[model samples]
Target: MATYLDTPGRVCRSLSEEDMELVHALQINGRASFREIADVLGISDQTAARRWARLRSAGKLRVLGLTDPIRLGNSVWLVRVRCTPDAASSLGKAMARRPDTTWVNLDSGGTEISCSVRTRSPGPEESPLLQKLPRTPQVVDLSAHCSLHVFFGHDLGPINKRGPLTAAQVAALTPPDTPDRATDATPPVPLDDSDRQLLDLLARDGRAATGDLAAATGLSPSTVRRRITELRSAGALYFDVEYHPDILQQSFRAALWLEIDPSRLAEAGSALAAHPEVAYATATTGTANLYASIDVATAQLFYRYLTESVATLPGLRHTATAPIQRTLKGPGPYLPTTA
Candidate 1:
């Protein structure tokens, strides 16, 4: 029997082991060289290059260097905007184009748009694009949830037990700890024009070569490299890879919104984070204090996990579940990735 990495949100249907191995390598170090990945996976550099080309051309994968909004002098907010059906498409697209939003999607049959935005200040008035909208008749309602803490995010990019890399192979690709990965949190630092350009390019493709970055930013290769290191150490740059859940045979997906006693927020977060089915979980401000995105093999499996697994957690007050209708934009820099 052979395995396949299903391409959801696209026409493709199957992916080979080599294809997944290539993805796994990039996930560990998005900017790794084809030759380095080839050496670790026991394939030729040419083979690794060919596999990457195939996956990327099919739109089954994307490797991006995403910056933490908090590290960029911004606050992260989860915003849900409800619009009339006639206005939803245009409104969703308009929201997606803004520089601050990520993971934008049309849920609840296209009448509701869910997205996370980065604001320069703490209040809703400080949101770069969303604040401009008036509560006109066309816009039915809007709610904003400020993300207070992130327990699991970019650090776990689609992790699964079925990953293609072996323990030894993964060990070979892991990079040594840098100051940026330290426990101490640092305040957001300002960026000049050149730094922004570099991040914009990396956001599109973190594996872009030095020469490519130099040309794009009009800086020498050495200068580009130096700036990248500095920004990284300052906790400004991190990389993540995106893939649809269907690829792993975990097709059922839903987002859980829960209200928990404030005193036990950490206990609830840590408990939820321990579940393999939980993809992304966080503590936020809004009607629900905790939000989680989870994927499972089927509805039965999801129900079992919820009743048997999630029900056991302490301080869990209320819960709500919304099936992700279609991902209009997956997580990444402000780019829109639609199904």
Candidate 2:
């Protein structure tokens, strides 16, 4: 099947110090010129450009804008799912393909899968993802919990952070007067095991060579090259970036867990998912109907989002904020590496 790689957020398995620095530079300011990044790292512009191409081509980096969903008028939900052991992967993939889904992950301890998605209701609403979900046939029973805030969106995008960026990288990455374009949809493609392995390599070390991927996947260098060509053509891969939330002055990021009527799930969830501010939204089964995270500049901004933005959403039962303390990992945690 064809897979699209343009999900709202991104993540990597691991990164080196220099790679982290590069990710930081882009996160702080994505529009930085090769020359500017070079200056900060004390490298040449040509070198910066070359390394960037490698990372970007491999889907180890991204340059996209993030907005606060509440500001865009949306409610949130967190879903904990209990599925048949054999049904988890199929169910998760189905959810991931939805336009409203922002993040999807499975935990090993149980038959539970967790997902977060956003929705906007006209007068406090339920998420639509639930309706579509039961119809898909992979899920058994679902349980949902509303979120007050995101403890951290670890594994969402590139970069590991305890707090804000340091002085130098931040200075280099500060958002430009004009930022990079943020598009949710992109092309699609078929991915093979070799492509997966190559993507894994770049996720950890962007500067890794084709020969390295060739060796890792047990394919000839030429075969690895062919698969990468297909992955890029199909849009199943993108680069990893070290985004600096502080540079954008986004000191606050939170999730609001909400409950809504199942009948109104589709209507409410669709509206919320369309907003630019919503990182991602989804419908799930259980106690709380929906969950999502938002990014904003300050406490006042958060209020505005709540009062004006979220107030207007449909099917909203309960809405409260739980702010993230720290992100232990990005949205997509690293896959285990072999060889």
* Best lDDT among the predictions, by candidate number: 1
**Clash counts for the predictions, in order:** 0, 67
Candidate 1 structure quality by residue, lDDT tens digits, 1-339: 011222245342446777878877787777778899999999999999988887777666778877877677678888888889998778877777777777776777778878888888877787646666555566888888888877677646455344779999888886553334323266677899999999999988877889999998999999998888777667788777876444555667677888989999989998887788887888999769998887776889989988998888789888887766555566664444343
Which lDDT value does model 1 have at 151? 69
TM-score of each: 0.88, 0.46
- In model 2, the runs with Cα more than 4 Å from the true position are 1-14, 122-126, 134-138, 150-165, 176-339
- What lDDT does the true structure give each of the candidates? 0.74, 0.53
**Model 1 steric clash pairs:** none
Residues 1-339, candidate 2: write the lDDT tens digits. Answer: 001132224332344566656666665444467788888887899988887787666645545323333333444456656678887766666666554554465544335566656676422246678656665556777755544333223212313342234776665555323222222332223345655566656545543566876778788988766665454334343333433222333555565656767777667776665554555455655545666566666778888888887777787777755664333223333222121
Q: How accurate is candidate 1 locally (lDDT)?
A: 0.74
Report how far off residue 325 is in candidate 1 (Å): 0.6
Best by TM-score: 1
